[model samples]
Target: MIAIFGSGETSPAMTSVHQELIARVSDPQLNAVLLDTPFGFQENADEIATRTIAYFREHVGCEIRLASYRHGGRATALEFEQFLSRLGNANYVFAGPGSPTYALRHWHDGAVRERLRAKLRQGGCVAFASAAAIGLGAYALPVYEIYKVGADPSWTEGLDLLGEVGVRCAVIPHYDNREGGTHDTRFCYMGEPRLRLLESMLPEDVLILGVDEYTACIIDFEAQSVTVRGRGGVTVRRRGTDRRWQRTTFALSELSHPQVAPAAVPDSASGRPEPDGTDGSPMVEQAREWGAHGRDALDRRDVDGVVAAILETENVLNAWAADLVGTDERDRVRAEMRNLVVRLGDLVRGGGREGVREYVAPLIDVLLSLRGEARREQRFKDADRLRAILAQCGVEVQDTPSGTAWSLQSQN
Candidate 1:
């Protein structure tokens, strides 16, 4: 699926530009589906949804499905799964603008991500705006940098539905909109320094595609080209001993193949074949096999097997993490570890203590911050009571030099 981004949809010019692009690829008699996953500026969601529906109806004469998800916080609804199932048969899917962090926090591994991957692989076209555009790549940028979350503005592992296709390619949407909010409006979304910092974090071969508002980098896999449609040119950054920038008008034929070949996992890192084992799986492969078995066991009501499988997965992930330490690939491995935790949480929900703790860690950090602040300002009684309350909920608190930390002592 190819994604698009713009500054904002409040303007008629942006909407018209998007409409024309859709018209270019859409057919009147064919049914096309648009999925609007707008997590940022939700107040404008209804307007954007209405405009999108109207655009397709007036131009393409195709049916549009507005899968408007307001809050994708946790525990995805089965209704969303059904919504994605519907998209599997769609001709086109478009996600609306929003915060990439929020969207990824909510939808990364849920039913929506799976459906999107399925649609793209089936040769369907997908367009994403703003946050959704960021979601289209392999990493979700922490756009909300002022927030504590932004301090780390490190890339989180995205759906991986696109595999390594968009790795190191940071999609700076609204690149030319100086009127848009933020200091990095012109150079980078954050600023030149921060952009450079981000670049330094990425592999040397990664490219930055700074697309202007109302413009799109249309990637056609079939044609093996990336064409620029609308008002702006695409910026290509090749950084080595020195950084070189090139601004070129693109056509649908340019971006068919990656500028650099996708990185491959080392054979030693790749699982070794089992000796006397028919599956010919390596250690990592065996670990994944056990993880899948655990998921299946959970689905089939074999709670005991699920527990065993989850522990085995954890061990494998830990070993993988150890191997990746101090390497450039550490963050990626850590992200995968987090994913494993999430998957394990899904399987063991209401099953036991381990399951609950896995799900509670992130939430616990948020709560501890609140409690720590209260205590720091001499609200000792309130802080102590809050801590006690958390203890009642099966959490144990430990005071640290940095702040207060907590962990689940037992799962109910």
Candidate 2:
């Protein structure tokens, strides 16, 4: 099974989807792993890993070990083997939120990519969100380079996992982006003009798989089905025509057999398709500037700064929300703004939540260690008190022949 998420991998908004996917494993002690290659270049890459681990533990109730193959060149032979071992063990693997190009650079022709392919071949689940999702196709958009750094629009050879599974397409996440509150920043920030140019660059048979932020398109090979889930829809674009699938199930076989309706090519004399009213919006442009600032604050771990930036963007959206509610472009911008706020909020909350998980897990470990010591010393009263205290706090301690294992009891 392949799960491609547009964004919000660890956010509360994605809780149901995560839970559903995790449930498919059918193993209470499933070996789940997180691939940190996507966010490997971030200054706080460790933070990203910790938060992702905590998200699985706290939100999904699945303890996910980190498969830290960030850079193969830096790894010892033993470390390389260990990383592969983890991937081999993992029944459910997840990667999210980083530079697609950077991840591609490290993952290119490596054991990590091969291991991922093997996992999918064996019917193990592969969940990719945001940048990782973008890297799963036949071609990846150089989102940051083209959008932020002002480079020419272009596509890079992706990991092509989908192609291996029979989907000849490029995955574009954050399809309904509105960070460019004034200009068109949709289509993973490429917008229509640049996206069309990039699309023209692709092989004619290759399709565009556009996943809106907060949405997912799950490709299940076993069932031969493609199901769209979440706040938005999945778009299949070919030759200037787009077919959107929303909250629906369709045969995966349809993807392999392309049935795109032909459209007349844009006249070479004019050079581009006519603009679809997605031009300049001063409010949207200002919102985009604030959105960038908010992202910077998140990277710096400045919670207050993130809140301020979100509020600044919110002010612009709130002021113009009414007027932009009707048009397709404006409505998408509003939706994008909403998603931006949620993502920024998740950054601050995820940091604090991960911190709590880190603190709590070790404290519980120490308590469990002491409980073992007290039991060994035959201090029944002390051991009982420790166990009771943990139980009172919703921690279930179980003793087995191997050792003591603990789980936070489910509140529900």
Q: Choose the strongest candidate by lDDT.
A: 2
For TM-score, the strongest prediction is 2
lDDT tens digits, residue span 113-151, model 1: 767766566556777766667666555567665333558
TM agreement with the true structure for every prediction = 0.52, 0.64
Scanning candidate 2 in windows of ten residues, the lowest lDDT window is 321-330
Query: At residue 55, what lDDT does model 2 achieve?
Result: 71
Worst lDDT run of 10 residues, candidate 1, spans 272-281
* Model 2 quality (TM-score): 0.64
How large an RMSD does model 1 have?
22.7
Residue 378 in candidate 1, Cα distance off native in Å: 43
Q: What is the Cα-based lDDT of residue 64 in candidate 1?
A: 80
